[model samples]
Target: MRKLTWGVWLGTSMLLAACGGSGGSQDSGLEPPPQDPRFVADNAQWREERRERLLQPDGWASLVGLHRLELNAHYVGSGATNGIRLAKGPEKLGLLQQSGGRVWLVPERGVALTLDGEPVKARFELKPDTDQSPSIVGFDEGNGQLSLLQRSGGKALRVKHADAETRTQFGTLEYWPADAGWRIDASFVPHATPRTLEIMDITSQLQALPNPGVVEFERDGARYRLEALEGEEGGLFLVFADRTSGHESYGPGRYLYTDAPDRSGAVVVDFNRAYNPPCAFTDYATCPLPPHENRMDLAVTAGEKRYRRPTP
Candidate 1:
């Protein structure tokens, strides 16, 4: 994504001022109440932390390649002649062999290599991210990282480089002004039995992830429901699309994380903390699209706006 320039920032500020505040359209009838000082400060801090994470050395922005392990055994490197050529790495990195449902890597003799941060003088087994401790091959003096990512289809090599253009020239992240009105209190309705949702990712792979429940909330006097997926640390993960999608937000959708529902079935769904998916930052990412049921009829002019990649 392109960094916001001074001119763009000035224009956005002017636009927000003209809109009589942020978070929604001037005529949406969902105008927020007086802004809370603490809410604004906390939201600002969250956005800052989000930005810093994306700018990290091996963050989403640093993703440079996703190559499938096609043949059973193949030479892998940045060289054009290699069977599995990488987008960025040493010319003759190593040879990867797959057999009996397992993969291993044999580093080239002279290349400086490390397997999980230790010197790699011999071939070692490569584990997929699904494992408790996935294997990582580091090269380029620690600037480049290689790992196996298990996708719906099969395992693929995910490459990230600290010097990737996406990271080195990261653009500014923009969001609607934080509003208390967007911080909605809702109810979590659990399923009678455990269920799964077939979510299609950017790569067109269908993933049957766990569907724990549904989050039902009221906005502008209209009730809406979003399917909730099992999230990290027992939280709730939501992928949703609103009226602003394609026009004012990422066309596919945005992601939100909320704490698990309390014993009383109450939950807080803070739209202000919604964020773009990894695909927004790098092409190498495979981000899930919002399920049809989660598409909202209302325009949520809060959270993130559509990202405009920088002009070459």
Candidate 2:
């Protein structure tokens, strides 16, 4: 297969200078380079799964539009059915509806939540935002609730709550290949406890995520490290860029999730699961950007490659 090229996703990131390196550039001292040229098969599997996520029954590729329901209104937007705004299936767009200071769905039944666009059947139980989890995945069609991304990642939306409109507008996730070289059997360097790291994003604004620690992996004969961000359910969220970036891949970077490593520091940093940020699919999202230290100099040739965004 052809050699994979990783690209920078969000913006022009200048190399980080704080990490132990020579001015965000080539190293004169780490381990030697690689001896082979193939991305491992395990890596490819991740990509296929990610692809299915976006194009299959429920992927982002099916996204049509993110209709903002108007508060105090009962009808769907213009030209919609019975004023019940509906998010279209794998082909159409749904209208956002608001009634009695709350958002309601069309029929509140037949309409489905597009996982990536296949239409998942469900509804958002409205609730008021408090310190507790806003969207606790409850069953009551109560008042004061919404999945507002800005007002807390839409706390009202629970896991598998259904009626997720974005699921329909999903775009396809592209990639180079699942190469073994990109699948690093990482060794985790633990911290005393989960530490809150102040990191910046694609927009140069600092965002906070509980970072567990660092993971060291080998590629092209060199040992590189990436700081893992903590996600819900003890999952590890990682953001990194490599040589292939800015060339064959997206210019900003890619994102990945991994199970927290074992005691011996053995965790599979699979690139196949690497996916495009929400920004890649829709503009209504405040997707977090990768940090400076997370940038890698080598090419990660696995995972969700890029989104083949068509002209709108």
Candidate 3:
């Protein structure tokens, strides 16, 4: 059977000072050569962009609920009596029906709602994320969104609201200092034939993702290899865990992305860019776990650390 290529759907700074007074034992004036300015600036920019993406109205942090759509129909809303209870929304938002391998939404009369940004008076089919253009049901005056998501286990509804406590109370994202040394040059080793890697997600759903090759690099005189997944845009997607996992980093693992190998099969694997998955921020996400092959015994002290949710 042909293996499936799952698409990866997702989305940092400081300053320093110099010394003066070249007398009294002649201060070296070389304050540890302040990490490559370019590298530091780039890393800072990346971190800031990452934070902005997460704080967006529809970002992972805004996710408030993930309800499985197993039944034929379900009334969804914030009301306690609704079949699918939402954390935030109008009392009678809409009714969803599943048929013909598709989910349809019927807006509740007298309730304001929009289907794909347009007013809807009749039931309409909801496009799942599998489609090129998925349908979005907007509610709460556009602050809330409802979308269909299909995962390894089954189909479900992913609800996001700008006012979600998770998003409103999001905490800080810590990281180890950005060091260029973490960016290592690696060589790609292609498989004789394509292979499938069994990736188990946070939901414990095992999926056979396309595993096309491996990247090998040497760190501390030891050769380290990571199996590479064929990303949606032809880049290399690496989900990995290291010695820092559960101690200094996210327990499950972190994600990293790299451009395609060059003509000489050379790729740059920058551990400094490794980041935590969405599951680290919210429980609604079904993030894939790192395969055993990608687990490194080496401690990767770079990239993001385990998220610390702020206290009320």
The TM-scores of all predictions, comma-separated, are 0.89, 0.57, 0.88
In what order do the candidates fall by TM-score, top score first?
Answer: 1, 3, 2
Better of 1 and 3 by lDDT: 1
RMSD of each: 7.9, 9.7, 9.8
Model 2: per-residue lDDT, tens digit, 1-312?
Answer: 122233343244323211112213222444534423344554455566655665542234433333333344344322435343334222222333445545444324433343222333554433333434433211212211123222322222212112344444444555554444555677778778768777765444565678888877776677778888885576688877665444445546678888867777788887756777755654434456667677776656555544545434
Would you give me the overall lDDT of model 1? 0.84
1-312 per-residue lDDT for model 3 (tens digits): 112232121100000000111112212344333688989999999999999999999999999999998799999999999999999999988889998788898999988888889987788999999899999999989999999998778999999999999999999999888888889999988889989899999788998989989999998888888899987566799998766666667777899999989878899998888999998888899899888677776778788876778878
TM-score of 2: 0.57
RMSD of 1: 7.9
Positional deviation of residue 233's Cα in model 2 after best superposition, in angstroms: 4.7
Tens-digit lDDT track of model 1 for 1-312: 121122233234324433434434333566467798999999999999998899899899999998888889889899999998888889999899998878999999899999999988799999999899999899999999999988779888899999999999888788887988889999999999999999999788999999999999998788899999988787899998776665567666799999978998899999999999988778889899888778777778778775666656
lDDT of 3 at 169: 92
Superposed by TM-score, candidate 1 places the C-alpha of residue 301 at a distance from the truth, in angstroms, of 1.2
lDDT of 2: 0.50
Predictions ranked by lDDT, top down? 1, 3, 2
Clash list (residue pairs), candidate 3: 12-44, 12-47, 12-48
